[model samples]
Target: MPTEISSPIQGSLVAIVTPMHADGALDLEALKKLIDWHVVSGTAAIVIVGTTGESPTVDVDEHALLIKTTVEHAAGRIKVIAGTGANSTKEAISLAAYAKSVGADASLSVVPYYNKPTQEGLYQHFRAIAEAVDLPVILYNVPGRTVADMATATTLRLAEVPGIVGIKDATGDVARGSDLIRRLRLLEKGSGKRFGIYSGNDDSALALMAMGSDGVISVTANVAPKLMADMCRLALAGDFAGARAVNDTLMPLHFDLFVEANPIPAKWVLARMGRCNAKTRLPMTPLSARFEPVLEAAMRHAALL
Candidate 1:
């Protein structure tokens, strides 16, 4: 079996929402406040400009600014993982280089979307980015959103490459996760290299961690940072019963946050909690009125309301 990897970034790394004004401008003040809240709430790290942050809508300049601003405002109080992935490997390289220049601790690069590359294509795409940039790259494999999935073999191949440290498996298949863990253990035994595996699916995070994954890059953590962090700590320590108890309370938040497309519901919950405005870019609309009460009930269930 693989020995522990001692990952620097673990636990509830919130894929945080980018706070926006009613006019759809970036709300740096609200973003800073949210970061402060995460730090005090024991969140492990902050993932900015991610899908939850609407990276698809934000222009390149805005994307760079968000990453730079987050790293600066965070001021070493917490680790900032910039969502620098792009469909084009060249674009991703540029963004990741910028992330490195701005002092971000790491970069989360998602699988190439829309183009639907083959496993070999996927390998070259990520390898090019890793070679172009010096920072640690966390591969994000969320085929549901990205359309192109990185298979376990491709992931293991990439794991051997220097500068590629870990992955966020959002496949939500426990069997697949378990198999990957088994394979990684064998690889680690021979190479003695530490590889971190984090769950991208919030609802399945406890199960994944119990199977020896490192942590979660969570959407639910955006609203329930303290509970999510505590749950991860418990789960990592092999306290499944304790983790399950915390996960039970958060189960509602986990399910409801996806009631609408991601940040829509997440933004609404944050606004309801007086954290940020419920504004998102065009293409991505606000949470529907009907889901408001449902989300409210969920928040109440988690004692966040």
Candidate 2:
């Protein structure tokens, strides 16, 4: 077996929501407040403009503004990780470069969506970004969204690429995650290179971490920041008992947030908590009224109510 992958960028990294106004304008003040909340709530990093942040809908200018605003306002209170993934290799490279220029600590790049590239295509896609950018690139493999599952072997190949620091495994398959972690440990032992393994699934985070995942890029943290942060901290410290206690409260929120396709329910919950307004872009609608009570119950269960 391989040894541990010691990375400082560990703990609950929140895949935060992009707050918007009633007319679908970016509510930047609300965004800054959310960042502050995460900072105080013990969240280790803020992944802005991510899937949860509606990165797909935001225009190019909006994207750059979001990254710039996050980096400027965060002011090193916490790590600001810009979501710079684009299906186009050139676009991904440009975004990553912009993130680095603006002082974003790192960039989270997802698998190329819609193209359904082969394993080699995936490797080249990511390798290109690593070569072109000086920033740390954390690969995000959410096959469910991208429709392109990155095999363990392909991930291992990319892990060796310079500037490619880690990955957010959103596949939600604990067995696969465990196997990858073990192999990565072995790789690290030989290469003396450490790659951060972060779980993108909030519900399954503890399980992956139990098998040695470094941390999580969590949607649940967008709502229950303190509890999520506490769980990650306790679990990473080998106190599963304490982590589970915190996780039990967050478990319900985890499923509820996704009940309406990410930022929908998440934005709604935050608005109810007076955190931000519940406004999503055109293609994405507000949380269905039917699920509001259900999510509210979950919020209450987690004491966010």
lDDT by residue (tens digit), candidate 2, 1-305: 21222464889999999998888899999999999999999999999999999999999999999999999999999999999999999999999999989999889999999989999999999999888888888999999999999999999999888788899999989999999999998998988888899999998999999999889999999888888999999999999999999999988898888887878898889899999998999789878889989998999999987
Q: Which ten residues in a row have the lowest lDDT in candidate 2?
A: 1-10
Task: Tell me the tens digit of each residue's lDDT in model 1 across 153-244.
Answer: 99999988877888999998989988997898789788777888899999989988988888999999999999999999999889999999
| Model 1 TM-score, all chains together | 0.97
Worst 10 contiguous positions by lDDT, candidate 1: 1-10
Residue 24 of model 1, lDDT score: 97
Query: 96 in model 1: Cα distance from truth in Å?
Result: 0.5
The TM-scores, one per candidate, come to 0.97, 0.97
| Model 1 residue 276 CA deviation in Å | 0.2
Alpha-carbon lDDT of model 1: 0.91
Error of 2 at 11 (Å): 0.6
